[model samples]
Target: AFDPPRLSKRADYSGQMGGVSEGEDVLARWSDGLLYLGNVRRVDSIKQCCLVRFEDNSEFWVLRKDIHSCYHPECHTPPIEPEVDPNSWICRQCVFAVATKRGGALKRGRFARLMQIMKVRLPYQLSSLDWDPQHLTNQQQCYCYCAGPGEWNLKMLQCGSCGQWFHEACTQCLTKPLLYGDRFYQFQCSVCTNGPETIQRLPMTWVDLAHLVLYHLSLCCKRKYFDFDHEIMSFANENWESLLLGTLSDTPRQDRCQNLLNALNSHKDRFVSGKEIKKKKCLFGLQVRAPPPLSSDQSPFIAEQPINITHRRRSETGAHQDLLISTLNSVLGTESIQTPLNFSLFVILQPFAKWLFDLKGNGTRKALIMPILQPDAVT
Candidate 1:
């Protein structure tokens, strides 16, 4: 039987082991890229094997030739004195990862240990930390609006409401990156968090307003009033041109006035206001104005308001006047114009009246005069 090489008995074997003793910290290079820093638990000189335990509580046995003293004078700065507890060792990679992941300053003990080991200065400014392998594997993949799937990039943000992930490019949120010190947790998508409905509802440009006016005029001509759909078609058919022209042209000076009139006359009983006709109903409750009398000077002067017509009733007058004023202020850009009651009423009601006349001819449509008011529209 062969005898074991005992360090106490054989001085040559002790010299060959490179001074790595039991219960001492060591750096072991197991492969070209893999390196482990651990405490030497046991030394088996008979088998030329050494048992080591790492910070992550993993143990391995390696040949004595692979292990180096943790404080090797040539490789690292020699410690002032040997550490009292060999178990208080931590790797440089783990120290940095822990500091970054916690988003806080490094621990005092770990910092002092790191200073002793590293010849170069530690870069504390680095933001990203290596995620724990087990934690990374357990995390759910992020899904972007474009259907891309992966872990969140630095530029990706999560919506607190929907639990969805979106890229900064997709969200148009090109704001600065959130700092660790900000302590912000909640985030919301644009649609989920409500804003002014008027922003989406209000017309953006003059062309948009023109389109809305034309749509509402067309609806009136079609007798598609929500409350009373049954009405005389003569009123709409007769005065369709005047109504269409007045409503469409803000100043009523466009050459297209005659063209629109001709179009309305040609269509007669069948009027198509396009696909989105339902949304045009908001302005339909406006009081119609009677056509202006022929101007003697031919300068297109404002119309004179009619007086004491038997058709004008006392109960409906107040409501109609209120509706007319609000419509002129909100829709027709007439908020600043101050005038007598007759002139103001004439200016406001003339376009609507012409449209209503085209819908019902000589007889007035009660439905056209009295509209179902929206709650917010009043006052």
Candidate 2:
């Protein structure tokens, strides 16, 4: 068998030309029958390479040893420069040119594949949008600006700009938890804080206040659904009307009234008492039964095991009472009041509490009534 020709050594190019000079014409043979005719734009002895600008205006880095002096009769004369605008240089071999010729869809597909292989995101889009669904599903939760889903342990601040919740650890700009006082405060996210505006403030609305209160209440009661029956609706409506008229006759009445109005308007959908029933019950008393209370196995929202009734009852008169009072104080921005406990409010909320706790009628009384009477809960 015949052997292939041995590759020439680097010393073979010595004395071929004085040296690879910048702006000097040369022919670079990268491989057999594959030659590049270009001018040496730069020579780097340290890198053992030369920056060659080809006839097509594109440039490449070729080893100095690979360059040979061109002495072709026509090569001796400098090639006429194309009469293009001096400011505008064109390179048909560039990435932009290749993408333009291949069309947008193919370019995008290739880019997407490359991003997938590299586990990276496109710079222009939100990181959240590019997250893998499987990762989100496996993790079950996510925090602000995190590319992957995760459970955030720290107290989160809601960004006024994006309305997304972010933990302090995730943001370099977030300094502290929002301070609660007699008045509302605005909070902006890390991104918005450094943006054009010095500070982006979120406006406080009655609806927003109500939503916050309701969300807290839902968490406390461990309930996802709430049905506002007739009694609750009447109590809310009465307080709302009293507030609007500025005639609510109770201590801290004005503040309480405003909070009541906010709560009522915010949860109007839950007040289903007034909706007329279209279908009448049959003479045999057929009725649609309410669904069973959520089982622990069904959702993470529900407790895995039943809470001890005795322990709950004791706490109802103790800690639970304090919780209710504090909740009312925080929401209404009021001190302790002398008004009698709002029994009607409890009556309205009883069914929901019963459903959530999976309590019977007697259990509902112990669970709800005791707590209200323990302290002057809410006026």
Candidate 3:
């Protein structure tokens, strides 16, 4: 609703003027009485200049003294309203609605960040940097590819984060159209472009730091345990994934590690799912369940760790102890699940077998339990 005053008469006085520029530092003189000014400050009080062209393509400059309200060139409808009273421009109702919807005016720190994100660059450099989008308002526009399919005007675009606009080309990949998804827009920047050479070219930003933190947590879960004992040694033996995701090891502080460990431990119950088998029970003492069949591809070996064996005689009666051994031995196939019994081996492997069951989860655990038996060749 910007309304400029109607010009009563033209003034001959040419005072020194400073205004926003399209490109060059000098003001372009139009055929009509208009002087296309440059470097104008972005102030609400100083309104946009409207240049009216004559029959021969000459123009006359109309300052705030010549216009009442702006109309869309096509629709002729005023989309924005003017400030009725600057002294008390906002009413209580409007102020409350704005506050309620926007969650309050943005803080200056966030405001500056938004401005920086939306800044764009020109293909060619100019002497004065005043023409940059960083200094313009949302309504500002620069010349676009005049000969392109669509005669476009590169408008000052504002970022959703910072409410600032830059040339569209400067901020996005020009090779393809952007794809917008449900929550956020997905567009490849210089950092996300594919190819080994391109990947090498990527400049690290805050986004890279955020991704590193998430990836580190993921690998820790896969390894079953988070190990940071020897950083130098570990890095030497680390894989490609570790190198790409190894920012955490550089820091001396280990305070945040507990939080990562706690998260993994908390989710352990949800991680594994399997059946607990029941075995033959005696009158005096209870027998534990049989070992469940391993999922396909899983090995009886939970992992490559050393087998830690400990035995305790909770009951004095020989019958109770013998029963426990009998059940555990049977699980280890010592009693020859089908052929012959090997009692000593069963006792030795029982403890490690129990630990393997504890780590079972989804397909990985199921696959782990199943042994990778090799087929025997016919003689």
Best by lDDT: 1
> Judged by TM-score relative to the true structure, which candidate is superior, 1 or 3?
1
238-327: candidate 1 lDDT, tens digit per residue: 433433233443433344344433443333122233223455322222222112111211111221232211123434544445544554
lDDT of each: 0.36, 0.35, 0.25
Candidate 3: C-alpha lDDT: 0.25
> Candidate 2 on 61-150: residue-level lDDT in tens?
876645766322212111214574646532211211122211111224553332222221111123333222111111213334322122
TM-score for candidate 3, residues paired by index: 0.15
What's the CA error at residue 70 for candidate 1, in Å?
6.3
Error of 1 at 219 (Å): 73
lDDT of 2 at 57: 97
What TM-score fits each model? 0.17, 0.24, 0.15
* Reference-based lDDT, residue 70, model 3: 19
**Cα shift from native, residue 159, model 3 (Å):** 2.8
Cα displacement (Å) at residue 339, model 2: 44
Q: Which stretches of candidate 1 lie over 4 Å from their true place?
A: 1-13, 16-18, 70-379
| Candidate 3 lDDT tens digits, 1-379 | 2221111123211221233233223333221112233332222233445454434455444342222221232211111236345464333212212221111122235432332222222111122122221122211222211000111112111222222222332232222211110011222222122211011111222222222332333333322122232331243234323232245435343533443334323332112111112321110110111121112111122211121111122232233334434544343445533212132233233333334434432223334433421111100
